[model samples]
Target: MNLNPDQVSNYVTKYADVLVDYSLKLVSAFIILFVGIYAIRLINRIITKVMVQRNLDPTLTKFLSDILIWALRILLFVTFISKLGIETSSFVAILGAMGLAVGLSLQGSLSNFAGGMLIIVFKPFKVGDTIEAQGVIATVSEIQIFVTKMITGNNQTVFVPNGSLSNGTIINYSMQGERKADLTFSISYDSDIKKAKEVLLEVLTKNPKVLKKPAPEVFVKNLTAASIDFAVRPWATNANYGSVVSDTLENCKVALDEAGISIQPYTIQK
Candidate 1:
């Protein structure tokens, strides 16, 4: 059917107005998005630099920056959608539902993520630190968002979940920059205790790896029916811990053997 002139003119005006308004809104949203991206990067860099200046751990700093950037970008996207004249209340509801679904499915990962964050914030341990946790003794190689990598004494690589690590007891052997190598030596009952102690002290002091500040300790620990036990401990830098322990033990045995202080096997009957 043919339309009336006035009716067509009014319809054309309304359609043109609607198109122009939507076009402007779309353009505005695009501009906001581009600007928002640049702003997010700028903000992330500024925060990361500040954290670096404060000597925050690099892993934590990077994780924080990425999280903050993601959250900001999500908000920016939401704002852009709102500009398109879509109902945000429904959008928010949809997001909440999706979030609930994701959270339910990823509870364990979320717990680990939170655990990792707590570890970073509390400074419980850092990269290159040796920590004992979860029945494993290893040196930390890297700290990630959900897991920590460790290198064992035998050159094994282990990945530990952050959730249990943060919740469990952690023995940090490298925190003090120095470690004590506790070595025990057994001597025959016939051996003179004074000679044994002197031999051990000499052995410890001669090792260049052992620290001289704390001084090496050598004393009669306990007397067994078969032998006398001497407790010997030497302080060494963490970097020298393994080598020092091995050297001290081997040297003590040789010194005792040469000094005629016999080391005999001792047994305790229960």
Candidate 2:
């Protein structure tokens, strides 16, 4: 194409104006990017401090802070792109769609994650706690985001999903710092009930593992055609629960035999 000198100058000026405009926008965008990054870091630090002040779980605090930081960075990127005169609404829409798709695909995982958050926040149980949930009685070994690892009495490890665990019933044996051992002892109907009660109470009281504040109790629970059942309850620290129950049962049998009270095996009558 052929043009006059004046026309060429006018075209060059027009192109220069466009270049300057774009350059200015690019500079502004970069400035915003750097400033936004600094702001994001500052916000993350503030949030972390707040979580620490609240004594939140370290893992959860870090996870939340990272999530927030990433989200802020994304927003800042969108802003920077918009400032550079690039369309961002479509990009944002695409991102939203992708997030939705991922969330739907990970529904169960998200639920578990939320449940874990609740567990960490509310603290239903802690590591080394003995808990009974979902028919599994085990000591919690580790508490993670999706599942809780537990070790059973037989040294077997089990992972319970936090989703169901948080929703279901949790029996924390160590929560109250004590546990009550419920025992049933059977005696021949001909045996003296008063003597049996005394013997069982004596056995419990003599056990050093049993707590004295609650003061072990023995009461007649039921009378059957075969024998009388005595309900023996002893309160003890979680550490001593097993020993207290076992020792009390052995001592009660011995004391009953010495007192001339006969104990009989309980049989189910059809």
Q: TM-score of predicted model 2?
A: 0.76
Top candidate when judged by TM-score against the true structure: 1
Clash pairs (backbone) in predicted model 2: none
Candidate 1 error regions (>4 Å): 265-270
Score each candidate by Cα lDDT: 0.89, 0.89
What TM-score, to 2 decimals, does candidate 1 have? 0.95
Tell me the lDDT of model 1 at 255: 93
- Tell me the tens digit of each residue's lDDT in model 1 across 177-207: 9988777788988889998899899988989
lDDT of 2 by residue, 145-233 (tens): 89999999999999999999999999998889988888888998788999889988998888889999888889998988888999888
